[model samples]
Target: RITESQNGWCWQGPVEVVWSNPPAQAGSPRVPAVGLHSTTALLQVTVEDFEVVCKGLYRALRIREKYMQQSLQRFPRTPSQYLRAIEGEVWRASDTGPGTFKHLEGFPLCLAEDLGYHVQMKDGVVYIYGDKAAADRNEPKDLPYPSLERFMDDMNFLLALIAQGPVKTYAHRRLKFLSSKFQVHEMLNEMEEIKELKNNPHRDFYNCRKVDTHIHAAACMNQKHLLRFIKKSYCLDADRVVYDAKGKQLTLKQLFQQLNLHPYDLTVDSLDVHAGRQTFQRFDKFNDKYNPVGASELRDLYLKTENAIGGEYFATIIKEVGSDLEDAKYQHAEPRLSIYGRSAEEWPKLASWFSEHRVYSSNMKWMIQVPRIYDVFRSKNFLPHFGKMLENIFVPVFEATVNPRAHKELSVFLRHITGFDSVDDESKHSGHMFSTKSPKPEQWTSEKNPSYTYYVYYMYANILVLNNLRRSGTLLATQTLLGRKRSPVLQYLYFLAQIPIAMSPLSNNSLFLEYAKNPLPDFHQKGLMVSLSTDDPMQFHYTKVQCELMPSCCPSLGLGLRGPRFSGKPADAGPPLGQPLEQRGLCRQKPLAANTACGCRSR
Candidate 1:
């Protein structure tokens, strides 16, 4: 049916899109994207390539800070951690230790300038000047920001010409994209990422709504008006053209930027019960009784307060999701499934709802994604706590769950990022140090004998079920859709964690990264099935595809899809899990699914 097509820049070759998430964003543009509709087409774009680009950009920016800082005394311990003396206030590197190097982060710009020359940016042009300048401008062999300029210039050059593939005129709507290769497309670079197209792709895929799987169902449009919002969100006009309420005027991409400009702020403002005393005005679903809104469920509070009146635009979204709120279904009062109240306390009820609805039990080629450890709604104070808890607590639990070698690497990580000295064998530079390796979960919290937080326990129980499902031959990444038999040792346990620096801000400084550092690509390599996701669309102002972009110019994270396990042997006839890790497909190279369901969402 020609579900989606690539225009702007074209390569006559069959263009493919591997949906990281099917319904990536609600009707975003005049053109259709992932979550605009619940379509069967799915594509998986690895985004590792873009991650490489982000790392490089982050490092380059780091070096620029060092050059501006000009602090030679405080030599950067590593290439990424810069120490510039001449700066007003130098920013710290997003990461540290040897791992940053592996990601292709380069030496600091100041040190790089020390290599040969020092160049400065005056107005818009780059030239050698000041003390570093030579009489002939050629005297200073080294440039101040050579390393930064060289790579970025090359990246910009490549990105410019690449998206505009040998300009073959294509038709869309009525007018042709014949002159589509103009500067606007070049500026937006909005063409389909041709380099990411997968061959022999999975044509039939799922597109569940993003951020809906989390405990914060209200963080979205809320249950009181959910079906109404859903109708507007996925509503199609007479031309089958998708428009969110505001989307009628602005494209989906523009809508996302607008959301980003004013993301939802999750705070004590959310725990506010006294914001208003009017009972009826309060959402009917919000109970002053059981499961009243609190810090854990701040999205609800944010919606009720900051987003109380969404103006004409929001009303339009409600109208669209309900198919105009006056459609036959609305008029008849038809009852659709109530997908709401996904709080921690409501897991049992939520699970039952999914089961009763045959959400996952049907072997329906679905992905059940749980949210990551990020906040439900975007907030200034959200990430620090989440990162602290994850590094300090979950790392140990995850270490125990995986095999020995993987466990050892996690231990190394603990040594480097933490401060506690090892009890048995001392190690250098640990992350959230505890005296002993794999200490009891009790060691993390002040409460005696309590192993982990309530959420961790919840996840552990769920992971046990997921692992069991994998062992019992029910789960096997994307292949499960084909109904193929899977091996016992192999697991389909997947996670969605987003990182930054992979691409630029929509304009200049769109996103702030520093204390919010998380680079978990290494985990993805070990069959963890970890890919990035956009958790809160309204908060993050991103479409799934926009969040997944890899700046065309960054270094490439080795692009290898998860290949097959069992080699030509039968699934049940495979080697046992006890074999050396290398022999098994624990680290296989096959593609994973992006069209599945997961809980918890992040920006």
Candidate 2:
């Protein structure tokens, strides 16, 4: 009886079969004639007898082929399916292979097939096996499989396709499958061997190009697991800098920190050396002889050296540090000092000195830096007197520089500092009078009236004072001192006041026109002026003359010409008529006189 093998072949019935008296031979028989017997009994057969037995053999093959194909219908063509179908053959032949055969090795033939093994039928079973040695011999040396040298490269290629973070379930399953095929523990050991080989100074592993695979493997894997693996298998030296694709050294310190690993040998010496190298690169003048300090150390140094430096020098340091200067220990310095001195007592003195010095010199740069000082003052409530001094001192200097363009900016600055509408009240001060109704130019020229220079100075002083008050957040006091009284006419007056400045050549023509049309007495006007002033002037280079006089030409015939023409009649006029009464002859009331003249003409 033929026993069917798991490999889908039956081989127990007979080793050979013969057929007798088939069809005549087409070609000449061999020196010894051979023929097939009709009966299925051939103890021995030679290659020459195949033709004589061809018909019966062919019939048997057709029957077997039909049977095998029908049996194969239940088996899938997938590697796993084929392996399962052929598992019996592999198990039966396990004793015959070169390797020591165990009854059940549980060798995961499924993975073996996936790795490109072939399945074949032998005896009464299917066999799933591969000749790894043969496969390796056939492949180019550069393309060896299960190779430690290529592992990292393969891992890197896989990693490039994955997004960052945890591995997907599908990928984990695949890894598990791969792990079953090869001895994972042995593979890991091999990886270590490769690492050691690369690190061997005598071997010139760099020339072999093996180290890159390790790096790629480490980077591509789950960072946590990769780090653990690296720590276990390789001696990762923190001092040894690794270059990335960009050619910049990937700081292992940062990577370790990101992984939350307290890296071995991460000492202060290492950090200092790294910092020194970085600093030297940045500032070529930086000397490496003096070891670079950390941020905390530098802060401490600043505090110690602050007193040694004069207030101006200290101020320079503060400006350099800006908001980054946050050492609570050094809070007792003079708040008004040019460099963020925090002492309330020193502010008035600093302010006084600044005011005195400013009068003799025009230092726009120094003036610009004063805002930072104000910020320091705000942080530490130095003194009310100091705040008052700032108002009295700096605002005037800032305002005095104003042309019509600067005046608008100064107005905006005042509004920003005071938190008061720049043009809210127009009755109290000429500073708010930007209207066509402003006092005529002749008024300032008269002896009784203030000179143009005097008014200019007054305007400058008011702007300075108001800005200081605004900076202090004393909006009420600022308004009391500088805000004009509100009036309906003042709205138009304010509109008019802005016209001259708005039309001045120095003003932003488009911006001024925008303001003139919108006429938001509080917000947009101040905002526009402030925006224009602080931004670069080169962008909107309006001449001062145009800004000063454009309002005066409005409401005139020429101005109205751009507006709609008045189509209605005069208010006192009667209804319109097509003809006059005189043309209608209704005024010829002397009828008798008219008749007499006609009779005389007839005679």
- For lDDT, the strongest prediction is 1
**Candidate closest to the true structure, highest TM-score:** 1
lDDT of each: 0.24, 0.23
**In candidate 1, what are the lDDT values of residues 422-521, reduced to their tens digit?**
0100111124422223333223333221111223222322233222211211112121111001210111111111111111122111122111232222
The Cα RMSD in angstroms, rounded to one decimal, for candidate 2 relative to the true structure is 49.1
In the range 1-603, model 2's lDDT, one tens digit per residue, is 223344332322111221133453454222222332222222222223323333222233222222212211111122222232333433232221111111111111111001233222221112223444544444311211122223233333333323312222222332233234223323334454444445556533112111000000001112232224324322544544322324444443443453454534434453232212233223222222122222222122222222212233223333322222122111111011122323423334443333322211110111111212222343454423222323343333233222212233222222111111111111112223222333332232222322222222222323322222212111111001111112222122122111111111121222122223322222122211100110111112112222332232111112112111110011121111112211110000010011110001110
Evaluated at residue 32, the lDDT of candidate 1 is 34
Error of 2 at 145 (Å): 97
Clash total of candidate 1: 60
Instruction: Estimate the TM-score of every prediction.
Output: 0.24, 0.16
